[model samples]
Structure formats: C-alpha cells, structure tokens
Target chain A: MHLMDTEPLTKLDPSYSTVMRIEGVLALIPLLIAGIALYVAAEVPAWVPGIALAIAALVLVFYLPMKRYRSRGYHISDDRLRVVKGVMFHADTVVPFSRVQHLDVEQNPLERMFGIARLILHTAGTHNASVTLPGLAHDNAITMREAIRAHVKRESL
Target chain B: MHEWLRVNPLSMAVQMLRTLGSAIVPAAFVIFGAGTQDSEKFAEIAPWIIPVLVVIIGVNLLGAWLGWVRLRYRVGEADVRVEQGILSRQARSVPYERIQDVSLEQKLIPRLLGLVEVKFETGAGGKEELKLSYVSEAEGEKLRETVRALVEGETAAPAVAAAGEAGEPAAEPTGETLFAMDTRRLFVFGLFNFSLVVFAVLIGALQQFEFLLPFDLWDYLADLFRQDTIAQAGDALAGYTLVAQIAAIAYAVVAVVVVGMASGVVRTFVQDWQFRLDRTAKGFRRRRGLLTRTDVVMPVHRVQALVLKTGIIRRRFGWYGLSFISLAQDAGSANHDVAPFAKMEEIAPIAREAGFTLPGESADWHRASADYYFDRAVLQALVPGAAAMAAIVLGYTLVGLLLAALAGVLVVGEYFLWRFVRHALDPQQVMSRVGWLAPRWQIANRVKLHSVEIAQGPLARRRGYCTLRFGLAGGRLSFRGLSLDDARAMRAAVLDSIAAVDFAHLPR
Candidate 1:
C-alpha cells in the first residue's frame, strides 16, 4: 500500500462528547458493585485500586471523549457521503447517494435536548448497509436528508 | 394463478400434523417426568390424560383450520397481495418491481405430499415475505413463472449480468451444462469432507430414547472416562506387551477413520446426489439431493463475488470449491456453490462464464506491511510466553516448557502465514488470497462494489498502514494492513468504479 493523507471533512458538534461522557458514567455502576464486594468480602482498605479505577473512569468520562470528538467528521460531496470516525481505529467510509435504499433522521432525548440529530442512509448492501452521521443540528440533518433524497430521485430518473 | 384464492385444504391437515410433531418432545418429557416421580403420580394423572390429549388435538385442529380459512392471496398485474388474519383482516401488498424473486421450497413432508412452498422474496430481508405453502408442484411453478415474467419484463434483468465484464452478454440459450459431478468424482470429494456428525446424531437419539436403553448411556460413558477409571485403565495398559498395545492403538485409530469417512460419504451422497448445475434463462439452476431435494436459481448480476477455497488435504491435489456469493442464500451459507469440489483447471471455465478471470502467474501479489506482521507476531507470542512464565513460577515446569516452545514457534510462523495473505488489483477486479494451509481466494468486480472503507488502528495510524474493506451485497472482501497511502488509493479507485455505473440500471 501507498502513503498519503488529504482530507476535507466537516467536524461534528462539540456537545456530542458530553453525551459520550454521560454514557461513560454507566461504567461506574460496576465499580460501585466491586467496591461493595470489596468492603463486605475483604479486610484490606481498597483505596489504592479504587483510585486507579477512578482515574481510568475519569479519563473515559472526560479526556477520551474530548480526543475522540476531534476525530469524528463527515463530508458530503456531489454524489456521495463520507464518514470518518474513531480515534483508535480510524474508519473512513464513502457511500454513493445512488446506492441508498432509504434514509432516516432520528434523535434520542439527549440529542433532542442538545438540538441535534443523526441522519442514517440505508443501502441495499449487506455490509455497512446503514451509514449514520450524528451530531448534526436537527435542521441540518433534515436538510441533508432532502438533499440526498433529491439526488437519488434524479439519478433513478 | 392471478385470482384471489385459498390454498389446498390439505394444508390444514399438514399444519395440524406439524403442530402435533412439535408437541411430541414436551409430551414425552411430561410422561417421563410423571413415570419417574412417586408411585401415586402416574395414577393421579391417569384420569386427566384422555381429556388433556383431546384438548391438545382440538386446539391444534382449530388453529390449523383458522389459518387455512383466513389466508388468501392474489397475484395481480402490478403487485402480489396477501390477506391473512382471523379477526383483524390484515392485507399487505408487494409491487412486482420490488419482488426480487419467486422461489419454491419443499421440506421432507411437503415433498412427499407433492406440495411446494412458494415464496416471494423482496430486496429488504431474508424470507420476510409472503409464503403460499402446500400448493401443488404444478401450481407453484406457474406462480413462480408469472412473477418472473412480470419482473423480467420491467427490468430486463433475466439476462446475464456478468461481473467484471463491460456491458451485458446477450442472454444465452438455457439448459447449458456448465458443471457437473458424477458419482466417482463425488466419492473423491467425499474423502476430503471427513466429519464425525454421526456422534451428534447418536447423542440426539440417545437423549430422545434414554428409557428404551438397557443401561443409562450417559452414566455408563461418564463412569468409563472417570479419573480413577482412566488411571486403572492406564495401569492395565502399562502391563500389556508393546506389540499388542501398538496393534490395539492402531485398531482404535482405524475405527475412528472408518467412521469419519463413512459419515462424510453418507452426508455428501445425500446432499449432492445427481448434482447438476445448468445455465437457465432465469439464472444458474442447481438441482441436487437424494431425499430432501433442493432446486435453486441464482440470478447472474446479483452475484457480488466469487470465492474459490479448498481444504488443507485437498489443496495438495490442487482441488478447489468455487462458489458464487449471491443474495440466493442457501439455508445457512451465503455462497451458492457452483462446483463444490473440482480441480483448479475445471473451475477456471466456470469462473470465466461468470465474467471473472482467475489470476494468472503474471498477476502482481502484495502482502501486508512487514511492520504489521512483526507487531502481530510480538502480540501473538506475548500471551503464551507470559503464561509459560507464570506456569513455570507455579511449578508446572513441563507444561510451561511446552507453552514456551509454542510461543517461539508462533513468532516465526506468523511471518510465514503473512506470506500467504496478499491481494492483486487490476483494471476491472480485485482479488484477495488469504489463509495458510487451506488458502482461499475472494474476487469481486470493482464496479459491483457498493461502498469502500479504509480503517487504521492506533498502531497502524502511527505506522502508516491501514485495512481496506469493500461492501459487496452478500459477500465479504477485505485486505488487512496495507500501506495507508495504498489503502486510500484503492478505496478511491473502487469508489470511482462504483461511481461510473448507474446503480438504478444495475441488475438485482
């Protein structure tokens, strides 16, 4: 393989990281269980390992999302949509609008609260049939959906 | 075939029998449970048994009758509609344009009864479609032809949508014998397909009929293999003469080999008897099986890729099984096996007919980055090496040494395995060759690919290498650990090929 990097991608809304942090908080429930188990079953004060887990959870809840948010982006070109995401495993996907079989715009309560939505394009292909771009302003997601639908309709004609 | 109609009334009987068939296991369980309990339990349930049996039969009969009465269908000019429901009266319609295929299936009972299940497959999901079962074979064929004619008229997709080649090849005359396997060829193929499925069937049989056996089979086997029993057996074996022990061991080995080979041959003969693949107007038609026969048709353009693979032992004789990766998924496998077992030379022609070219000696092949292999080697060795160290420290010196040796071998073998993984891209297609002893090749037309992805892990991102994955409708083709630049270039090339085509005009 060869080596070159050229990208023209649009970054997602920064607030999406806050949603990830909220999700990361779920990880602490397990830690809480472990702490109870340690107190009931053990004789040693568990502060040493407890601090390590707390620091790791803090990174997961705060620092990691901050870094990951920078890596998530999408680019909609003339006839295709490109989604580039992941910090550890960077995946750059390109899906032609013409191949799309259906489109969906969805929002959860958290996303609604943040005034953002995710636009999903479902293609007929079994692998990666659905390509989703989240963290778009709700209106922006709606606008993108219409743009893609029109492009696909014109192509079919 | 066009009018709104009810299915054969025989379906009600078949449905009731099917319900009764499913009830057998639970009924047996309850009977056994009662028999094994206190003496009074059997006498207590005896009075209610006849009434319970009557209630069960009544319910099954009522359900089957209701289902047969409620189900109705009409294959209209523009769409196929199915109306079913005892109370709500639900009606659903699928446009002729959206109906991708009309297929027929017949399980053992249905086939014996001269009935076939007609299915209308749409593009959305597997078998999430209207089914008309227990129809006469003749009616089923007529229904399939009607749907096929309607679909073909609008899309002109009945013709060859050969991959890798430019434009369409004019539809050839049907019933051309493309490939076949006679009994002798099948025997050789069966030799390499050795399996121990008889043991699975035996266990299932044993579980179902445990009370009929003179001894508890599970308990007897567990006692035979118990720790103390094995120790005693080992001691008894140690007293035997070397020659006698060698002959006993050899006999056991021979017995296992005979059983495996016999079972494999039985399975192959039952599944592939009189196997014949023909080029038909609808697509490639495959007719096979001795008992539960299957006849499947896979359209040409719907074939996304070609997979040529072989077993470790078969590879020595240059035999490969060629299958078309298409939307026509057999019960479990996505591949439509054209030649389940054939030499490379024989498989070439079949590949050619599908518009795919087998890579020649001159075709370039490039492996993943050396750094990638090196990183994997270290990672692979780390676990075993660490385990060996911990084991040795805990005093299991012999096992530790073996694990240490395994780690050493893995470090060197990783590089050797990397040599077998490579891909070559050409003007029209990309072919990936992977695996070690049983090498497999996956080839797909660049134009047929729907999407392209380039992925890089943290280590790969640092090392400037990536994995490239292509989205084929029902097939998989991916290359791991290519130089990032090459990965991006390949993705762009594939995307360009996909962009050049009008997807609307692409065949289903």
Candidate 2:
C-alpha cells in the first residue's frame, strides 16, 4: 500500500518547539567540545569534524518541524482506531477498538511546559507496543483518549 | 530417643579433623617463616600462639559436641519442630501445608558411618524447614512415614469431618503413584548428563595445572601435566605415526569417560541414593539422599505448570528434566522460578499422576501468525548486532583492511539469519515457548495475566503491524508480527479468556 495515501490529516501542535529546545540542550555538550576543538587546533585539519558537527546541529535544528510533520491525529472508525504517522516514511496503523488493552497519557517536562501531551495506545503483543502521538495540545490529547476509551468499551460489548 | 536411632558418635571426630585441617595450613606457614628467621622472636610468641591455637581447636571440638547434643527433631501434628544450636538456642517449626518438598542426602562420610541426613524443603519464603543431621537408615524411613501420615491425616480429617457433619457423601481420594524410578533408568539418566563430563574435564584440567596452589602430591601431578616440556614430548610422539594418533585420541576419550563416570556416580548417589516418593491424600512426598537426607511435600493443587526440558543430545536419548512453576507464596524476589518436580521419559503420565492434563503432544505445531511480524521486525533489530559485528571485525583486521570488511559482512549476515530463526513464539495453555539454542519456556494461567499492551513503531506503522504483550501477574508474554487489527483481536481474546476463568473452581 502507498504510505502517503494513508497519512493522517491532523498536524502536530506548534508546541513541539519546546521539545526541540530540550533536545538541543541535551546535545549541547558534544556540540561545544567539537566547536572548541575546531577553533583551537590550528595544526590539525578542522574542517572534517567541523562539517560533521554542523550537519548534526542542522539535524537538531529541524527536529521540531520533523516531529510535527510525523505526528498523526487519530480517529475511531466503526470497528477500529486508525492512526497515521511518519513523514519521510509515511505510514498508517489501524488498531481495532475492541483490541485496545490499555491507554496512557504522558507529559514530559518539555511537553508539560507547552501544555502539550503524548497519548499512548497499548495492545497485547510480544513486545509491549504503543502508538505515541507526541506534541498534541493537552485538551485535544485528553479528548482523543476519552473517545478511544469509549469506543473500545462499546465495541468490546 | 533410641540408641540405634542415633548418628555415629565418631561424626564428631570427623568434624574435629576437618576443623584441624582448616586451621593447620595457615598456622604452619606463620610458624615456619617466623621460626626460621628469628629464634628469639619465635620463642617469645610461641607460648601465646600455641594456647590460642589450642583454644580455637577446643572451641571447634566443643561446637561439634554441642551439635550432637542439641540436634533433636520431632515430627508433630501438622508441623515439624527442630531444636538446634548450643550457644544462642534456636527452634524451627514448619507447618505441613507450607512444606514444599523433602530431600534425603547421604554424604560419603555419613554413608561410610551408616548415617543419613533428612532435609525438608519448605515454601520459598523460609530457610530450609528441617535438617536431621544424623539418623540411622531404618529410623529415617520410619520418620518419613510418620511425617507423611501426619500431614495426610491433618489435611484429610478436616475435609472428611466437614462432609460428615453436613451429611454429604465424602469425596473419595484417588490413590496416585508418587515416585517412579528404576536403577537402570537412573543410570541412563545419569549417563546422559553431559554437563558431568564437562565439569569433570574442567576440574581435572584445573587440578593438572596447579593454578589453585596444590598442597601435596596432587599438585606435583598437576605440574607434570602443565609442563611445556612434557607437552612438547607428547606433541612429538603424536606427529610420529598413525599408532600415536590413534593412541592420543583413545587416551582423550578415555579421560573424558572416566571423569564423566566419576561425576555420574557422585550425582546419582547424592540425588537418588535412597530416593523414595509416597502419595498421600494431600500431596506427593519425595525423599532422597546418601549423606544429607531431604524430604519435600508439594500439594497437587499448588503446582501451576509442569515443564519438560530436553537438549539436542538428550532428545536423541528420549530423556528430559521435569520442572514446575508454582504461585509465589510471597510476591517478592522468588517470583517465576522453576522448581524441579520430577524427571521421567514421558512427562504426560507424570503430569496426570500429579492431577493435571498435559497438553496434547503434536509435532505439527503452528507458529502464531503474529510471529511473522516479529520475525520481520528482526531486520530493524539487526542494527545493533551489525554495529557490534562491525566493531569486532574492524578492531581485529585493522592490519588487513579487505579481510576485515569481508569478515564484517559475514558476521552481519550470520547475525541476521540467527535473529530471523530465533524470533518466533508459540503460545500454549500452560506454557509459551521462546528463544533459540538455549530455549526458555514460560508457563502461567490466563487468570494470572494482569495487563496487556499493544505498541507500534514508525517502521511497524508503515507495515500496518503492532506487537501485543500480555503481562501476567508474575511475568509476561508477547506476540509479534500481528497487523494492528490482528493485535487488537488477540488482545480481546486474551482478556475474554481471563474474564471467563473461574478461579474458585480450581483445586486449591
């Protein structure tokens, strides 16, 4: 199946900028070491490591946009909850409402700062599998959670 | 209380000898070095050192005497009480219901002295229930019978009395065969344990090297084997002719078999020396040992799952070890551990005797379709394996870059194939089978499952697949390779089964 065709319509909330900053801060130590070594070592060829560090920094800079593009809004159909996620490798996962074993709503410090949340939907599988929707507006995440829970209960009966 | 029932009084002498052997080595070294270097210094300290050594030896002798005096045990109604320890004074009581299993042991020394030690396996939470250090063979048997009767009487009386009072027909307790092992079978079973050969070879090699500091002629023999000169001479002889080659091979095989036989004899004597298992109304009773005897009783209902394990070689011989996983009396540390219940050629009959229906034996087993998704997931899992393979190959072949690259590719390919073959799961009623070479099988009831989870990663989402994990009360089970729809379906099926189980009707 073509992945792009099944991509979810909903975009990640703009609050993912806070997540990008947290990731950047965590990445700062190695970035600083690379920058200092590049500046101080005149006898050594600096351009190689300098270019590598620059590429990594650039990747981190686009983290929020990439996450926003990949996060999918979920919808409950008659028998299943359809999830669409992924940007470069756009994909869809459809978990039947009756099969949902449990649901979790998590808020990390970065997400909490921006009033954003992550919704995890769990099913019974060998490896504990969950579909995480990151950078969702808190209210929307809660609403989506309740809707999934209600749908599961109704279908299970 | 009877004189014949007592252990040999000479057991104390053996203990004293052991204590002296332990103390003499260090003391001798200290005295020898000090005495040779400084006569005056040694003379000044000899009086103090000798008295201290005498006191230590005296204390050991006294301790052995007290152990003989205070080590009294009695099989009472509903429990076994053991009074032991000389200085602090200690008593242990184990209720009949709490006793998990019993073991009988006979150490070489004790056997030579015609004494046996009886040990009781209580529930996981307590220290070993009881240990009867020195008892005659016949007395030990009588004690085992009396305890078995008391346990059965205590549990049976309550049920019968209640039935009588209610004017209901008493349920007939079925007579079950408890222990079954012939000497020929034990010999076959012992022979098949290859671990004994490996252990013996390892011990022999270690002894031959003098790596552990030999104290006597044993060390001299070890040095001879370890000498490079001897090894060179042997190698020269080995290269000379076909006869030498044949002799070397024969010698190696004989060495291994001799070690294996020694190990087998020791294991058989210790584990099944005077093995006895009795069936009572409450549960099965097992007793075995040569020197240190042990007795264990396990109620039939408490047995949660029975497992039969066979290795590649053992499978050829049609031999397997039978073990059980039972509910944890305590929810803490001892969770999900297997207790060996029995070993027999066919586990089904033993399981039936233990009051449980064994799953049907079907070689035509189908992998849960979810296994395919889990299998495909291995490609993604190979990332780490590939990285490790790359590092090792690169690290070793830095001098020859082309060779390193070729090795790296081969390693990665091997890992990919191994991972692909190892990633399937089969869910069963009592147990789930997983793993590859050293297979791990886990078993529990659906009613014991506490939670379930379904998860999907970015790659898995692309494939429309998710994993389903069933978290039981004590442990967990997982199914991979399921489409989202299938995962959900499996989850509902598991939950429904869990809800339908009426635990109250299960034998308790």
Candidate 3:
C-alpha cells in the first residue's frame, strides 16, 4: 500500500487532559484486580511475589507508550490530515480533509494544570470518526482549529 | 382554556370498569384454583377476603377517576402542551417544528362514545413524546388536521379557530366517519395463511395464562387424532372410508375458508376501523386500531428503505403489504417496533408522494455487482444448517441413519433459501433481493449510506472471497458471495463516492 505524503497544515492542542488521566486510571484497575486475585489464592507459590513484581514492571514499561500517546501530534494538509503516534508500531492515519464534520477543543482538570488542550475532529461514519491531538498550548489549539475550519470550508466546497 | 372542547367524564369511569373486568377473569381463576388446592385454608379466609377484594376494586375506580381529572392539554401558537400525572405532576411541550408525524386512533367503545385518542411523534427516543387519550372524535380530527397543516407549512389561522371551537362548551362533528376495508381484499389478505393470527392467539394465551386450557384449539385437534374409534373405522373400510374421508376433508376445508374470512373481517374492522394515512410536509401520518389505538408519523428523509412483501396466498390475488424500516424514535409507539406497518399496494403511491422510488421500478437499477451471483451458497447457508442438525442429532445420541436423513433435508432446505440472495450495486445506489417464498427487493441510495464493511471469515479466506455490507442510517444491505478482489474494489468505489458526493445536493 502506498502511503500518502504528510504536509504540515495546522496543529491542535485539545483543552482536556482528563483523557490522559482516564487512560491511566483504566490501566490501574486491571493491575489492582490481578494483585488482589494473587493475594487471595491460597495455592499461590512463594515466588509469586517476584512474578507479580515482573508484571508490574512490565506495566510500568507501558508508561512509555502512554507518554508517547500524550505527546502524539497531528497536522492537517490541503487534502488529508495525519495523526502521528507510536511506541513500537509507528502509525499514521490519513483522513481526507473533506470528511471532517466538526472540530471540538476540549479541556479538563489535568490539562488545566499544564495549560494545554486536546482537539477532536469528528467525521460522519457508523463508528465515530475522531482524531484526538493532545499536549498543545491552549492558544495554538485555538489558532489551529480556526485555520483547519477555514481550509475545510474552502477546499470542501 | 376553550370551553367547548372536552373529553367525556364517563370515559374514565368506563376505562376503569374495563380494566377491572379484565383483571377479574384471571383473578377469579387464580383464587378458585388456589381454593381448590386448599379448601380448608380458603374457608378460613373467604369472608374477609371477599370484602377486601370489593374494596380494592372501588379504590381502583376512584384512582382512575382522579387520574382522568388531572389529565388535560392545551394548544399554543407554536406548540402543544400536555399536563398529566396525578401524583408526580409532569408537563410536556412539543413544538411544531420538532413534530415528525401525528396519529389519531379510536377504540370500539371510544368510537361509539364519540371520543378519539391523538398521538404526536417527535424525533425523540421511545414513544412517550405526547398523547391526548380522551378527546372527542371531532376534536381529534381537528387536532390532527391542525398539526398536519402546521408541519406541512400550511396557514395556522384555521388551526387557531379549530382550537377555539374545541375548547368551546359545545358538541361538534356529530357526523361520524367510519373507514372500512374492502371485503374481497380483506378475505384475500387473511385467508391465505392463518399463521399470524394463530401466532398472535398463542402468544396472548401464553402471556395471559400459564397453562394451556384443554379446550384450546390445538389440543382439540390432537385429541381428534388420538381417538381409538376413528382409527378403527379407518382400518375397517379402507377404500370406501378413504373416499368418505376425502369428502369430509373437502368440507372441512370449505368451512375453514369461511371461518378464516369471518375472522379476517372482524380483524380488519377491529384493527383498522378508523385507518387513515395522511401526507404532510414533514412525512407520512398513520393511525389505526380500535380499543388500544396507535398513531405514528415517520419523516420522509428518515426512511432508509422500503420493503414490499406478499405471501403465496396474497400473491395469487395481486396484493402485497408495504413496510418501511426507519430509525426508531419512540419506545411505546408502533414505529419503534421491529415489525413494519401493514398496508395494501397503496403504499407505493404514498412512497412516491413522499419522494422515494419503489425499488424494482427505479430506472437507475443496473445489473447487480458480480459478487452476488457466486456459488457460495454451500458455505454460507448450507454448512451452518447441517452443522446445527448434526449438533442436535449428536446431542441426543440419535441413530446415525436418522441423523443423516435429517441433516440431508436441512442442507437442501438451506440451499433453496440461499438461492434467492441476489443483489446489485451501482455508483449511486445499491439493491438486494432475498427471501424464497416471499421475495423482497430493497433499494437504497448511496447518499443515505452510513457505513461499509468488508468481512472475510476463515472459510472465505480459503475460497478467496468476502462479503461487503452497506449500512444505511435506517437499515442495512449485505451482499455476500463476492471474490475478495471484487469486494475490495466495491469498497473503494463506495468510499470514493462518499468523499466526492455532497449528500445535501441529492434529490429529495
């Protein structure tokens, strides 16, 4: 498959950092559940703690991907938008600029602390089409939103 | 408040009596059954229980009366407001712009009582948007006409006058209009197959009572076959009895035909006594039913596809029922249910009026995509049916010969059904035809398409084929039996169409 070229168009910084917090919280629940299960099982071997520590260490390793996700960026071009993110599997999804239905800049408590935001772009599809570009300065997110909205209007018509 | 428009005060009392009467039959049965099981226990409590039951009925009637008193509605310049609820105190206001459809219904008693129920459908979730249950038949018609006019962008001045007349302390529209079904068509529609009626009766019996009564029709038929006297007579006069039996069977068939026609006439009048379908600017308005009336309004644009069905019997008479699959907006309303509305061939004309072309009649229909005609029937339908039969046979540890025979028949039946899965895809449209005995063709425009999926299972992978399913806002279109390459090509074409076309520019 031929990959589309990525050209810098505009950047978005969504308002909310709660999404990142939600991700962290979701990851913690499963780890906690596993730890509780191990503790309750009477037949667990002596070396189980070591195994649990290894699993926790592996989970901690996932912090890198989460950080990369938090730092992931997106740019819209004249024809398409590119979302760049990866820990191992470097990926880019090219959404045609015409498909963009609406754009939303969201901010939550965590993003408020960092004075950053996230921008969400919605497209018309059965599954909600959205690209969340996080970790951007609030001012930059607003400017990027206006620039993209204008480009969408000009090019789509 | 207008003084002339009023619901009957006695209507509420009648409603309460009906509810009590329905409950009494089952309640009496339960009490009697329990008493029979424990006569001594019943004897101890009978005297006190009897008075308690009577008091309960009286209290129910009082509550119903209060409920009727508390319920009232008002019509404003741009909206309809209803105030209901005896204890919680709730009110609803539905604006004219948001109104999708309006329905009017009148029960047998209500019809005789000169009262009708009005329902307003909005694009909100499940059916409870707004309802006025006890308006006079004239008021109901006036309200329906007013709402219909408002939605269709007609002058609102007449509506204001109608509302004034309704609120006035005077009776109006004493001329009752009764809509009747064509008797010949009604018999044709009902007599072909009693499956639906039988199914409905069975469900009603099951839900209303747990045990099937010995007097049940199916039980009676079973007893007739089980009688030893009939079996002996059959054995004694084999040839002569056979001729007599054939003559008896013919007579029975004629009787059944007559009974079926009678049942049809009764059903037609009961279900569609005041049946009406009105065209409005927004969409179609439908209302029918006697005791528990229903009203539904479906917006024109919201309709995804139209399906026309005809059973073998109906087909012989050139009559078919038309139903549209639409996005559900109300829970308690008929529009939200899985079953579609039953209307005669007249639906096609209405659909054309509402800006939709009947499927087969469309000049835009091109040859279906090449994938629809492939030999995947064995994989898609036959294998699954056979596997199911196999599982059942093995689970029961049935004899191998018997299992083989059953599985063979199932596989054959599946293949026959699968033969009907034909489809066609175009740049701007997609059409599919399915069903064996009652074939149905669906055509949906690409502009209305919501999503597309390309699926390949394990077997599909080996066969180098896949299925492409097109999802519309209101329904779905699935075309199986395509080569993987062809499926991918179709998907790309659809995506390109979506990207290039402006849906708003499409012809409405």
Candidate 4:
C-alpha cells in the first residue's frame, strides 16, 4: 500500500502550517479548562491523570498540524483542479472548470496576516456544492479564481 | 404576447384566513390569560370583543387586498416575470429556456375554488424554484403550454388547450397510458406497503384530547395490570381447551394484521389515488393525490440518472420501484418515483425511456474488494465488541453477552451487505447495486456528473482502497471500497467524458 499518489501533487504553503498550529492551540484552551475543572471536582484524585492527558494533547497539538500540512496538496491542470487534503480522513476532490458556477477568493484576518487566501468554487450539485482550496498564496488564489472564472460557462442552473 | 395579470380575487380571502390563522395562537393565549388571572379585566375586555374582531377582520382584509393589488405576473415572449412586495418590491423572471418543467398543485380549499398553483422547476435543487399561486385551473394549463411551446422554440402555431383532465398532454384520449394504477393494483400495492402509522396517530390524538376521557389512561392501565385481572384471566384461560386458546391467539394476530393493512390502504388511497404517468410532448407527466392533487412534468432529456428500489417484503413479491433522478428535486426526495410499485418486466420500458438498462445477462458487474468490506465489518463491530468487554468488566454478564451477540450479528450483516454490492461502468454510463435486504440500484450518466471525489480514511489508506463519489445535481452515485489503481482509472475515464463535453451547447 502506497501513501502517496503515483503523480506527486504540489504541497500547500509552508506558513499554512503555522496557521493550523494556531488553530490547534485555540482548540486546546477549552479542553485544558475542562481538564482542570475535572481535576478540582474529583475527590481524592492525584494530579497524574490530568497531567498525562495534558501531555498527550500537547503532543498532538504540535504533531497533528504538521501531519495534516504534509498530507494536503493541490494540482491545477488544463481544465480541472484536484485538491487532496486531510490526514485522518483523506479526501481527494476534482472539479472541472466548466462545471464551476461561480468563484470566490476569501481571506480571514489570520490568513491575511499570513498572506494566504482560500479559493471557493461553487457548483450546482446538491451535496459537495462548494469545493474549497485553502492555504494558497494570496496573489496565487486570486489568479486561480480568475483562471477558473474565465473557463466557467454561465448557464441557468 | 405579454399579459400582465393579478391572481384570482378569491385568493384574497384565503390570504386573510392564513393571516388570521397565524394570529390565532397568540390571541388565544392573551384571552385565556386575562380570563384566568383577572376576571375583571376579561369582563372589561368582553364588551369590546365584537369591535376588536371587526377591526382585526377589517385590517386583515385590507392587507390581503393590498397584497393582491401589488402582486402581478406577466407572461412575456421569452420569460414569465412576477413582481411583488409593497415597500421593498422584487421582480423575478424565469427564462423559458431555463425551465426544466412545470407542475400544477391544488390543495383542498384551492381545489374547491377551481384554482391551481403553477411551479416552474429549474436545474437548481427544490429550494429556490418559482411559484404562482391561486390561478384558474385553465389559466395554469394555458401558461404551462405557452412555456412549453416557447421552450421548444416557437412553432407554426400557438398550442391549443387540449381536452383532458386539467388540460392534459395533447396525446389522444385513446392513446396508451405509459403506466396507471387502478383500485385493484393500488390495493395490492397497499398490501405490500404495510405500516402502523395509524396507531401512532391514534395515540397522538388520545394524548392531545385526554381531557375528554372519563378516566385517566394511566390509571386504567394500572387497574388492568393489577394482580386480580392477571390471575383471573390466567384461570379463565387455563379452563379453555388447547385448540380454543390457539384459535384465540390466531384471531388476535389476524386483528393486528388487519389494522396494519387498513392503515396502509388508507394512506395509499390518499396519496396515490388514480396515479397516472404519461409521456407527453413536454416529458413524463405524472398526476396523483386525492385531496392535494399534483401535476408534474420531467423532460426526458433532463433526466440525469435512474433509480430502482424495493423493500425486502416487496422484492419477495417481485415488486420494484422506478424513479428518475432529474434536476427537479421532488419535495424531500431527489429521485422522482415514476413507478412506485411494478415488476422487473414492467419497469424495463420505463427504464428504456430514461436511457438505462437494468443489470442482467450481457451486463458485466465487478465485485468490490474483499479486504475493503472485511476491514469495514471488523471496524464497525469493534465499538460494540469493546462495549461488551467493558460491560463484562463491570460484572454485567447478561448485558455483556447480549452486546456480544449484537456485535456478531452486525459483523455478519455488514459482510452480507458487502457481498451483495457490485458495480459496472462503461463508456456510456456507471451503475452500482447496494443493500442486501432491500436492494437499491442507481445508474447515472457519466457526462452528467458535476465533479468527482476520491476519499480514503486511515483504515482504507492502510488497506490500499478508496471510495469514489460522483457529484450529481439532484442524486447520489458512488462506488465505495475500490483499489487505488481502479479508482484512478475510473476517474480518468469519467474525466475524459466530462472534458469532451461543450457545456455551453447543452440545454439547461
């Protein structure tokens, strides 16, 4: 069993890893609070269980972001865009340019600081109607959106 | 021809009633609260009731009238446009070329008033379609025809409203009906559609109006459960011969079955009375429902896929349901059930009309990877198996044993599901068969797919298998648990078909 696709896909921007780690730290704050609350609530409990759990979470908070960053990649061909993402639950998606109904290049404050953006392609399908490719260079995201937009045929859905 | 018109005047009264209905709940709360908390206030308000009622009625009528005056629709040469709203007005137009179909609906009150609602279905899912309510039935039919004619491109003459039930397709009255269900067939279908929903409704009604009953239902049940009743009944049963007891049990079972059958028959009669499907110049025109009659048309060319489904009980009786996965999502369902109950032979012609062939001799279907399903079965049963182990650790032997048995059954059932599943793909179409107890088959045109997705979970990655899913506008088609190479190959094949299509030239 091979982990990688036969043709290697281009990896996401390196700074996206930092953004993912920031998100991981944000997720940990609530869990850390819950762990401390449980440690206080439990009668006659040693601090060892909570410490072990915290250590495990701390490891994951640092380790999982890099794993996810490594797993995600995207390839743009002549008429289609294939995006591969996720480490635990991997999904490889391909959207044809002509099928795109609309396009958007969005940037959150965090992404803006990192000089990155997400490109969203809207299609007419009920499920999977929006295919998003995040973690692109800000300028690159705009370029891709314009390129896809040019190929998009505006027809009544 | 452009005709700007307002809806039937009778609709104003219906609108008023609807407005009043929404206000009734709050009004009831206020009135009842006043009566309970302060009798003096209620009495003080009593004398003014008639005047207040009159004012409310006047206001409601004025609003309805205003709405009616403001709402206007125009049938233009190229599109149908509707302008509405009082202060913040909006004008919506649907081009004739974009309309996938037109459906006419009539609820009980509107039917009594001889008015119907016309719906223009587009390629987008059901949510944002166009609707025109409370028009004369004849007007609705004419509008449908004009749209149809315009969509097909103007011909020599304008379409004339044909003579049939609600201006049916121009097909001759003597023309062979593609499919129809008479009372007898409906009865057979009812027998297969066995349900106990009526019991649930009955229980709900009992709960809602329990005040009418002389005694509390809980107290009655408690009384019946008392020792005396059980002992007396046991003694009485002990005196009866074996044959008599068996006969009594049989009668009880028969009674329960009759109740289930009655409910199924009643629902079938209400929902599908006089069901008819006909191939018209427009497409497949389906008409059904007793109280709320609906008329919907799906263009043959617009059908993206075909679905055939059946329950285990119905399948045993050689009954299969046929559906069309068109752009118009029918209510909550993606596939429109064209023939809800039919035999395999009967469904062939309908499938042919939708451009699909059911799996049989000459058709080749490949089995899914054994490791994919086997690993899936093991993974699915792990949760329950671990739960059983925990239960045993807690010293609950009975619970643990039961959980173990359940886990075993799950493994066996999932394995059977995987064994029954098969998939077939060719240059023209892709098809898959899934489910063991109640089999469902979906056939989708390769060119109609909007996008492709290949997914792999941790277990699948280790096992060298992937799941391939296709994005359809109003349906689902997927091949799960394929080897990576096979998945990539299929993706390439489908992508080739999609890339070759010049979507601008295709009809909307």
TM for chain B in all models? 0.86, 0.61, 0.68, 0.81
How far residue B14's Cα lies from its native spot in candidate 2, in Å, is 12
How do the residues B102-129 of candidate 1 rate in per-residue lDDT, one tens digit apiece? 7777777787788888878774556567
lDDT of 3 by residue, B39-61 (tens): 89888878877797888788878
Candidate 4 structure quality by residue, lDDT tens digits, B83-168: 98877898999887677777899887788889899988766556788888879998888887777666655321333343333475
List of chain A TM-scores, every candidate? 0.84, 0.72, 0.58, 0.84
What's the residue-level lDDT of A101 in candidate 4?
A: 75
Model 3: residues with Cα > 4 Å off, grouped in runs? A1-157, B1-8, B30-54, B152-181, B196-287, B290-302, B310-319, B327-351, B359-419, B425-428, B450-471, B478-508
Compute the lDDT of residue B100 as modeled in candidate 4: 70
Docking class of 3: incorrect
Please, what is the TM-score per model?
0.83, 0.55, 0.64, 0.82
**Over the stretch B66-117, how does candidate 2's per-residue lDDT look in tens digits?**
8778666667665787777877778888888665445455666666766666
Candidate 2 lDDT by residue in tens digits, A49-136: 7787777766776664466455555554444455566554444454544555678899987678889898887754323356676777
The lDDT of model 4 is 0.81
Q: Which runs in model 4 stand beyond 4 Å of their true positions?
A: A1-5, A25-61, B1-3, B12-70, B77-79, B83-98, B123-128, B151-176, B211-242, B379-408
lDDT of 3: 0.59
Note the residue pairs that clash in candidate 4: none
Better of 1 and 3 by DockQ: 1
